[model samples]
Target: MTRYVMVADLRRCVGCQTCTAACKHANATPPGVQWRRVLDMEIGEYPDVRRAFVPVGCMHCADPPCMEVCPSTATRQRDDGIVTIDYDLCIGCAYCAVACPYQARYKVETPRFAYGEAPTESEAQRHEAGRIGVSTKCTFCVDRIDSGVEQGLTPGEDPEATPACVNSCIAKALHFGDLDDPDSNVSQLLAENQHFRMHEELGTGPGFYYLWDRA
Candidate 1:
């Protein structure tokens, strides 16, 4: 079984929103529906303060609460551990939104454009008609992953198969790979780093891991 995960190295993250921009451009998510975002965190006090830029998005948990609460059965987790939303089945009741501890889900009721009323050709091209009035979140670039794999490419290692955010990471803070593979990049990093997952107590088994230490 294949399991995809993302590892974020805090040391290399410079709080640059390049990943966020790349996500927006690639997904063409509506205004205020950020599938991927970097949270600027400041720790300690005054002179001893430390800044950390943590990227946050759909963790694609092993135990997905969103999928559980979806009354319409719109949310489902793929065999590869990618969580996806079926827009046709979704009722946009926001049940998944309320159930999510990560706050990864979004309900876009109205459409908005970059230039107010009229949308540009590029915006229109990227827009998904199926996403409107539906619960939306990150898909871990599943389309790219599937296509890449079919073409004999490794998703987490290949730039074309990886998530846009990971590919756009200027500092190489983000890493995507198969956690199930012992020799995978993500597995090696997790094995060597002092890492933690957000809200693990909730038992989400979030695929996203944060590495605070180099060794």
Candidate 2:
């Protein structure tokens, strides 16, 4: 009953977007398809206005609408709360993308590179052929988690097991851990802070949490 989750501290985030760059490099996502992004939000009136850099991506909900709407059954959720897409089974119908409320899904119809028509050596080496012409989203670096577990390491505590975005946060704003474990980092964060989830009213049961204030 290990439920994985991420917690982002709004107070600590500086909108540097290091997490975004780390995600791009780790996942080798094509241009215009950002699996992880920070939304620069402005709150309050003119004199009291302030900016909030909210890091967001796939929520990996307990009840994912994308999974329910997938006609091909390409989208699936693991027991640990990670949502993944099977490119081979996907038909590129974009049904899951349409059903997603967070707009975290992307459908790249053709192969594109950062440098025009040609891909750089690094891009070519890391390019995933299966990702083309299919819906793609963040997996929270499940491979790292799985491998780390096999090696007797604790995810979220171990850099090799943690999500790249969480590990790359310069401000230490992002956190990942098991929500089901009360002693886990994410669980402690939620218990000690005033936090909220995006679109929680929809009842998707998103695993991503935002800490707005100390409790």
Best by TM-score: 2
Q: Using alpha carbons, what is the TM-score of model 1?
A: 0.97
RMSD of each: 1.0, 0.8
Residue 74 of model 2 has an lDDT of 97
lDDT at position 87, candidate 2: 91
Question: What's the C-alpha lDDT at position 68 in model 2?
Answer: 98
* RMSD in angstroms between candidate 2 and the native structure over all alpha carbons: 0.8
lDDT of 1 by residue, 1-215 (tens): 89999999988999889999999888889788899999999999999998889999999999999999889989999999999999999989999999999889888877788889778898877777788889999999888899899999998899989999999999999999999999999999999999999999999899999999866
Which residue pairs collide in model 2, if any? none
Query: lDDT for model 1, on a 0 to 1 scale?
Result: 0.92
